[model samples]
Target: MATGSVKIDVHHITRVEGHGNIVVDVKNGQLKQCDLEIPETPRFFEAMLRGRPYMESSHITSRICGICAIGHATASLRATEKALGVEPSAQTVLLRKLNFHGEMLDSHILHAYMLVAPDLLGAPSVVPLAKAAPDVVLRALRMKKLAGDLCAAICGRHTHPIAMTVGGFTHFPSKADLEALRQRLIEARADVDATVELFQKLKIPAFERDTEYIALSKPDEYCFIDGVIKSTDGGSWPVEQYRQVTNETCVKHSSAKRTRHQRESYMVGALARVNVNFDLLHPKAKSAAGALGLKPKCVNPYMNTVAQVIEIAHCVEDSIQLCDVLLSRGVTWEEPVAPARLSGEGVGACDVPRGTLFHNYVIQDGLVSGANCIIPTGQNLNNIEADMRALVPAILDRRPEEITLSLEMLVRAYDPCISCSTHMLDVKFV
Candidate 1:
């Protein structure tokens, strides 16, 4: 290990959804501190939910994150429906799944091409890459547009969807619109192959640290919007017991909470889902994984982006099948399912683009009295720190600038939704 004294302080890390800082210190060839500090103040979405009409929970909570709005809406609706005893129709389930596919595609494509690609290609951001590789940028934009249009066709818009609600959707896409979307998804396969090729050529950092992986899983399907919370560490818990699984505790360094379960830290996201439900992936996605050299039980956090690309392929193929099913069955107008009762407590969970998201609500006399939501990023903070601690020691021989880039890449690999903004890395040698 070649180290004297090195310090890296990245103020407001770029390309993520929220604000966070990376702080590292080393002295006399020994690591002293490595931390991913989250300074963004709490938004208090759960507190905001109390005293609101039960019907409004989904809409209000959807405002939590534009990237995860559909996921929030779906989870919020499930909690409300379960508390109120409303069971959506089969058609509703299919439509909601299709809407979810749109979001998965939208978010994954944005991250893979726009956010993370810069690091892999050694550019500052996608803007420079546009001039360097125009076709790749155009491909990303095309796929993103298709994802957005798909969401609009189903949920009345991608970000903070307006159609989705507690019992069911307030709007539905026409057959013509769905058929057009299906055609586009079919056409997008070429781009999907191109994506696989792009990632295959770019090398991911060779690093592995075994950690517990968690996600929503079903025995028969690649569960996304619903299922039991399962962990690779050897147990499954219903979403109701998420508190036990998460074991969230406050940390002095972060305004956001840190979580641990079955270990000091557990990971959730595309890699977790892939490890937990590899068999359930669509056949084409499995093939993509093979080509990309990703397999179940992968521990490299850097490979999460590859897992995301694999999921993108899965979303496209499965969405086409869902479209075919809807077109074949012929959607019919149906009233939104009404609650059988007004007072009960329920929890809902979904494997969102980021990871497993949980929303719990207690409804009393048609008003929400209590609420709890655990975001993926909150669940991941501790794990990110754990990774940083492990990584810094191993790379102590590298120059300070190279070490700084590696740490930045490590954080960006997790794709933490801390906030949206980029800032410079400030290093101090003491």
Candidate 2:
């Protein structure tokens, strides 16, 4: 708010998971309040996990987000495995990495093509893109299909995977099967490169906000399946210490809780990962990042879309490398990871598509006694609104449609899976 009055109320932002709204109130050039309100009824996924058997918790929590089903399931499995004192074999870890890479590819391609592409292309949705940029749309579809097939090969289903379990997969893909999938991945590299080049041409706004970045960090490579929680402010903690870093608090404007570290806001997802671990990116992804003019320590929220494009390249190359390792070592079909009756607490932390996700569990005699799952979207809720607060003021002089588009694009950049985080609240009458 500077010289005039404006009101922007956008309900249920399009091309994102679940429902979210942007609300802004300004009067006489004074900012009253600006918020991204997710008033969706809390989904209560935590409560659902409680009292469920360790083997069933992943299957139950995997329902939190249709787009991120594998991430949720992976987190749940890691937590259950840890609490039950189960350690997966080397082959299991490698296979899980493959599954993780596939999840990343699946979600990133969907966001880049189906959700974020229309905004840059000036199309209402992907439907029009089919008519306008038929080849581009077709390529995106092929990329998505290829990634989905990888999931099916590894997890036994494209959407909600059935093969993943507590300590290991119920079924492992044969060498011949993995080799086939590897060939498809190798073939898809050209398309992934095209995607990076495509996003490079998009018109992303130039806006910068200095904030803390958080993600899972490892010493050897870009972490996906496991790593310690890290913050850009030089704070490092184990997954079980998440309560200290997240410092989650309730806000009346949204059902999803907001998170903060040393500052009022912190960013997660691809941007944070790139900011922290750019060196570990696969060679192909690193080249894509350079081509797109993206470098480490990027602070612009709008560049998150670019970061995602870079991440797509990384996931693809990483997937190929994982395939090489699996084949060289040879895969073995081991017994499904079965958990023994135990009483303890454990936390599973991993880099999901949206960002770093944590699933903490307290198990009593092999049944989940309590659960807490922190999703990337939930962590970035405060940051998104904070970006909005900064953005609307800068573009207040622009047209209303421009303002709305800016805000909507900001949210879409997060590729938020709102449904994954909605169920983490408890309310009582005051």
Candidate 1, 11-61: lDDT as tens digits: 877887777778888888787877777777677888889999999999998
Best by lDDT: 1
Deviation in Å, model 1, residue 4 alpha carbon:
1.0
RMSD over all Cα atoms, model 1: 2.1
Question: Which stretches of candidate 2 lie above 4 Å from their native place?
Answer: 337-341, 424-430
What is the clash count for each candidate, in the order shown?
A: 6, 1
> Where does candidate 1 have its weakest 10-residue lDDT segment?
420-429
What TM-score number comes out for model 1?
Answer: 0.97
Candidate 1, which segments miss by more than 4 Å at Cα? 419-430
